[model samples]
Target: MVADAIYSCLPDPKEISPVETAPDPEDYQFLAVGFWVDKGTADQKAREYMTKIRNKKIGVFGTLGAYPDSDHANTVRERVRELLKENDIMDLFLCQGKVDPELVKMMAETMKDDPHHSMTPERRARLKEAEKHPDEDDLKNAQKVFEQIMVSLNN
Candidate 1:
């Protein structure tokens, strides 16, 4: 959804490609990579792609299970920044996304024995809150952010 929102605002002559099937960076003047955060870090594929991209204007947008402005989200953002510190990151945007109930259930079962398990009441509540997100407002904000990114890329 975030990628769709960003694509909606991007100029023509643009192509969206998956990181697995990435095209040559030299073929495009600007690039935007979007991914879902997993285990508190940018997706591994995104990190790998970043390593191959250099000397291009780049923007990153992604979704997480945490609220967009939460401390956890901020830390994830900082981690992404560090990961791409060698590249020219034009902007970074993140928003909350629904957690998979199946994954949550599996995690809960796996952590049932651990005292410091992640399936705490607070975590479950946060996951519940995430179910409503990447909502209309989130998509709109993603579009706006990418629109500005496009403008910056043009300049």
Candidate 2:
């Protein structure tokens, strides 16, 4: 979704700039960027561009489009291998189209454990007041129902 969010913000592919400064690998240590490559660009030239990004110490990650390849799978693999070898870049790999159900369950479990994903502190404080004063039975019941839904998702 980060890719979608970033892509939606872009004005035009040309305006996005062909080359970006090597982002600090540590700051963007596990970053992944997906883009559409022009069919005319030679694989060698593409590898050269990836090398430039690698020199900046950022881990360059991307996915290749299938449409350009006559033998799509093999072409993608060969191109990926060529880029890896030439760029001295590691940790680059293909990305999946959607999150799996298992991953969704895992995310649900993670959200339950992480307080930062929960209600805001101010909201929690108000809820705490409600708990002590025992007002608004309907709101309390709704909170219980929300908690059940979260629990069910993880299960």
Candidate 3:
């Protein structure tokens, strides 16, 4: 949904490709990549694509299970910034996204005996809170941010 919102805001002569099948970075003047954070970092495919890009105007947008303004989110943002430090990054936007309930249940069951397991009660509650996200407001914000990115790209 976040990617969809960003896609809607893109100008003409744009091409959309999955991170897993990334195009050559030099082929485009500007590149906007959308991804979801997994295990505290940008998705593996996104990381791979970022490594291949240099000297390009880049915009990154993504979703994560943590609250958008949380320390965890900030860390993820910084990680992405580090990956793109050699490039001209236009902007980065992140927001809460729904967690996979089945994955959460599996983790809970598998770590039931580990008192210090990562999935604590508070973490579960935060995941629950994530379920309502990537909502209308998130989509709107993504569109707005991407529009601004386009404006910057043009200038």
- All candidates' TM-scores? 0.90, 0.29, 0.91
Q: Model 1 over residues 1-155: C-alpha lDDT tens digits? A: 77877887898988987889988777888888887898898889988887777777788899999888898899999998888787788899999999888988998999887876568888888899899988999999888888888777677
TM-score of candidate 3 to 2 decimals: 0.91
On TM-score, the leading prediction is 3
Clashing pairs in 1: none
Candidate 3 local lDDT, 66-151, one digit each (tens): 89999989999999999889898889999998989998888788988888556887988888889999999999998898899887
Give Cα-based local distance difference scores for all models.
Answer: 0.85, 0.37, 0.87
- TM-score of candidate 2 on Cα atoms, chains taken together: 0.29
Model 3: residue 112 alpha-carbon error in angstroms: 3.8
Clashes of each: 0, 0, 0
Misplaced by over 4 Å in model 2 are: 5-28, 40-49, 53-70, 86-155
> Using lDDT as the measure, what is the rank order of every candidate, best first?
3, 1, 2
How accurate locally is residue 59 in candidate 1, as Cα lDDT from 0 to 100? 87
- The candidate that wins on lDDT is 3
* 26-142: candidate 2 lDDT, tens digit per residue: 343222333323342224544555554443222322333322223543556456645545343333333212223464456456776677444455534433443332224422433
